[model samples]
Target: MSKLCLVTGANGHLGNTLVRALLAEGYRVRAGVRDTSDTEPFAGLDCQRVYVELLDEAALDRALDGVEVLFQVAAAFRHWSADPEADIITPNVQGTRLVLQAAARAGVERVVYVSSVAAVGHDGSALDETSWNEEVENPYYRSKILSERVAWEAAQALGLWMVSVLPSAMVGPNASRLTDTMGFLESIRQRQVPLAPDFHFNFVDVRDVAQGLIRAAQSGRAGQRYILANERSSSFADLLRAINAVSPGYRQPARAPRWLLMCVAWLQEAQAGLGGRPARLTRSQVRLFQGVRQEYDTGKARRELGFQPRPSDAVLREAFAYLWRRADQ
Candidate 1:
């Protein structure tokens, strides 16, 4: 009998892709979606739907029934809010706890937590499972750090079979046109964005992330964390040029002084805090430029789980192609 895999946040870009991948691999998929009626994206897919919230005990239990593996991909993903700490902190930490508990209660064989590289330390070093970004003075990063801590504690306490996969700057075509990465790419392609940072990030393909999650579910070592980074960390200039190569009108941003950007960030933060609206330059967004360069030691994943990520350029080209086609439609 094929194992039953429950994927939370099944309607999301990554979650939805994961479900499709799981189905392709012959696992029965149970998608935990908040709205059962919004099933158009999952239409004709070999998957069942579980209408539930992360904290809904009864509903969560119902979803966990007969679930041999669980993929915790759901999280409150937002940066600017009146109480960002509450909006991000509670759901991520509490929701993860509840999901793990539900999995343990249901005797699930394995659980894969799709964490972010935001949880890793940004000390200009090649980060891996052992490193973490606990010292960052930002809300979103703090929330991710706290969530990973929660996962670690739960793994130790329940003796649960779990592995954490931390992916950096997930870029792919499926992200909505409004997502941060997609928006950035779109603006760059349209010559609407400016002030590109002179920095780099470990960009991972969303398809690779989906693949890593599946590998984690099957062959991953329990209680371990894996950093899923592409072979090369692309510079902002390189990224701009890559997009420009495809989109004729794509333009690069003029570099701005770091201090000037800091002032703008402060003003944006103050305005949002007082007006209860989204901030232009959130603390997370600010630190993203100032934080340590994102590079990772994927040797562990290679030796253990046979993870071989493609080049960043290849993924970016594919994403650009997909976006180009979608925009034409």
Candidate 2:
């Protein structure tokens, strides 16, 4: 019998790509999302649609029944929040616990929790699965770390087989028109980023991340972390040039000074606060740039999980193409 797999957050970028990967692998997939009516993402896919409220224990219990593999991919990721603890931290930390608990109670075989590289915390050098971003004081980053810690704890305590995959900023097919990356790309295409942050991080195709997520479940050691990150770390200038190189009608972005940029970030945060929305440049993002160059080492994943990531350039090119297409309509 085909294994019954439950993938939460199926409506999200990585989640949708992962659902497609699972379907391609011939697993029986149940795509879980917060909204059952928002079916556009999962449209025409061969999978069951299910609604799951992360905090609802009874709802989770009902969803995990007869599920062999659990893909606990749901998490809130806001760049900024007036109340990070209640708005962002609680949802992620509590969601992981509830999913793991429900899976264990349902007697699920194994769980593949989709995590972010934000949990790994970059330090401009090679990073393994053991790397945690404890130094960074950001709500989104904290949420990932705490959630993964909780996942492992519950997994060990409940005797439920669990594996975690930490993917770098995933950019691949079927990107939403309103994601942060897309926003950045649009700004680049429009020359809106007068000066980009000097921050650096790895990027992995959503499809590659999805594939690696499966590989983690198949071969990853329980209680260990696998990073599905890319080999290249591109800077903001590099990104602007690359996007300009691949697309037309894009001017080169000038590098704004650090002090000026910081002031702008402050204004952006204040504006967002007044509007009750997260700013693109949160205090966290600005602070991250002042530190050492951030990057990750995926050597462990390649050696152990047999994972192979594509060139970041190819991913960026595809991203530009996708955005360029979107700009027309």
Tell me, by TM-score, which candidate is best: 2
How far does residue 289 in candidate 1 sit from its true spot (Å)? 2.1
Q: Provide TM-scores for the models.
A: 0.93, 0.95
RMSD list, candidates in order:
1.9, 1.6
Candidate 1, 1-329: lDDT as tens digits:
89999999888878888988899999999999898898776878989999868888788999999999999998877666788667877888888888888888899889999888789755566767788676556666777889888988987798889999988777775554345666666666666556766557677778788998999878988888988877557777777767766765655667756676777778888998888877756545756755346677888888777888878887777677777777887
Write down the TM-score for model 2: 0.95
Candidate 1, RMSD to the unseen true structure: 1.9
Where is model 1 poorest over a 10-residue stretch in terms of lDDT?
Answer: 173-182
Candidate 2 lDDT over residue span 210-321, tens digit each:
8888888788888788888886687776676668667755554566666777788899889988998768786667776654565778898998888888888777777777
- lDDT of model 1 at residue 38? 88
Q: After superposition, how far is residue 304 of candidate 1 from its true place, in Å?
A: 1.3
Residue runs of model 2 more than 4 Å from their true location after superposition: none
Clashing pairs in 1: 120-133, 121-132, 121-133
Each model's C-alpha lDDT? Answer: 0.79, 0.81
